[model samples]
Target chain A: AQTVTQSQPEMSVQEAETVTLSCTYDTSESDYYLFWYKQPPSRQMILVIRQEAYKQQNATENRFSVNFQKAAKSFSLKISDSQLGDAAMYFCAYRANRDDKIIFGKGTRLHILP
Target chain B: DTAVSQTPKYLVTQMGNDKSIKCEQNLGHDTMYWYKQDSKKFLKIMFSYNNKELIINETVPNRFSPKSPDKAHLNLHINSLELGDSAVYFCASSHSPGLAPDTDTQYFGPGTRLTVL
Candidate 1:
């Protein structure tokens, strides 16, 4: 069984600054996928970014990027130039290449301070 | 158009009542899933269907039944809902059954917040 862990229960970042959310997972599979999903107060789940285990390079989408360290089983999300809209409950997820279920971690609520 | 949509964004019902939540995907994905987010914001998979066939059924209560009339729709019917069932349910779809890098990328719908009072 694969389990994702998000250590931070809540985080606060000043607007226009950067913040990083830590995530770690335990999985026996060598090849898998990692993802970060954000859920705002509207309750809409939006995919922020994703990374493939086979790729050593991390995944980046606009202001969101991931530090995917496969060896350490760490996949952290970095939000550059955080905006008020970025404040949300962010979840880190893991899925095996051949599996249909995605395991998610307890989300970290991000607060943007002006 | 919404890639994936769930009906009744907010469901408020009395305990012991039965209710159903509907989900549909317009992305033509072959696989659809149901997830429950508890009050603590922990998300867990409840059920999954691939092309109208039941694929993944987690350790959810039998009261929570999922029906799929077609590959594009998956509806959840809960019987005798309890206070513990008050959570946000999310519907998601993905083009899966393959090992493509993008195959398992799921598109989620605006969740349905179920409140059992």
Candidate 2:
């Protein structure tokens, strides 16, 4: 069973600044995937980015990027140039290769300050 | 063009009631999944189906059931729903199990907000 952990309950960042949300997972599988999802007040689940375990390079999507450390099992999301739209409850998720289940972390509430 | 969509964006019902949420995807994906986001914002996978075949059924209660009649549609049916069943349910879709570099990102639907009173 794979478990994702987001130690931070909440984080705040000034607009245009950068913020890093920590995430780590417990998985014995060698091949897997990691993802970051954002849920706003609308209750819509939005995909921020994803990283493949076999790939050494991290994944980047516009202002969002990940620091993926396969050995340490760390997959942290970095939100650069944070904006009001980026303020949402972010979740970390993990899925084993070819497996359908995607386990999510507790969550981290993100606040963007003007 | 929405790749994934779920009907009944909001559902409010009493306890012990029965309800269903329907999901559809136009991405030509073969896999669909059901996820529950509780009040605390903890998202968990409850069920998954691949081409109408049950792939993953987590430790969810028996009252919660998932139905996949075809490749592009998956529905969730809850019988005798309880207060704990109140949560935002999200449906997602991805391409086949293993294809290409596995470019499927699992596009998600807007989600259905279920409130059990």
- DockQ winner among the candidates? 1
lDDT of 1 by residue, A63-83 (tens): 999999888999999999999
Q: After superposition, which runs of candidate 1 have C-alpha atoms over 4 Å from their true positions?
A: B99-101
lDDT of 1 at B117: 100
RMSD, each candidate, Å?
1.1, 1.4
Candidate 1's residue-wise lDDT over B4-102, tens digit each? Answer: 999999999999999999999998898999999998889999999998999999999999999999999999999999999999999999997574547
Q: Clashing pairs in model 2?
A: none
Task: State how far residue A69 of model 1 sits from its true place (Å).
Answer: 0.8
For candidate 2, lDDT tens digit of each residue in B1-117? Answer: 988999999999999999999999998888899988888888888888888999889899999889998999999999999988989999998876566455446778999999999
lDDT of 2 at B85: 91
A-chain TM-score, model 1: 0.99
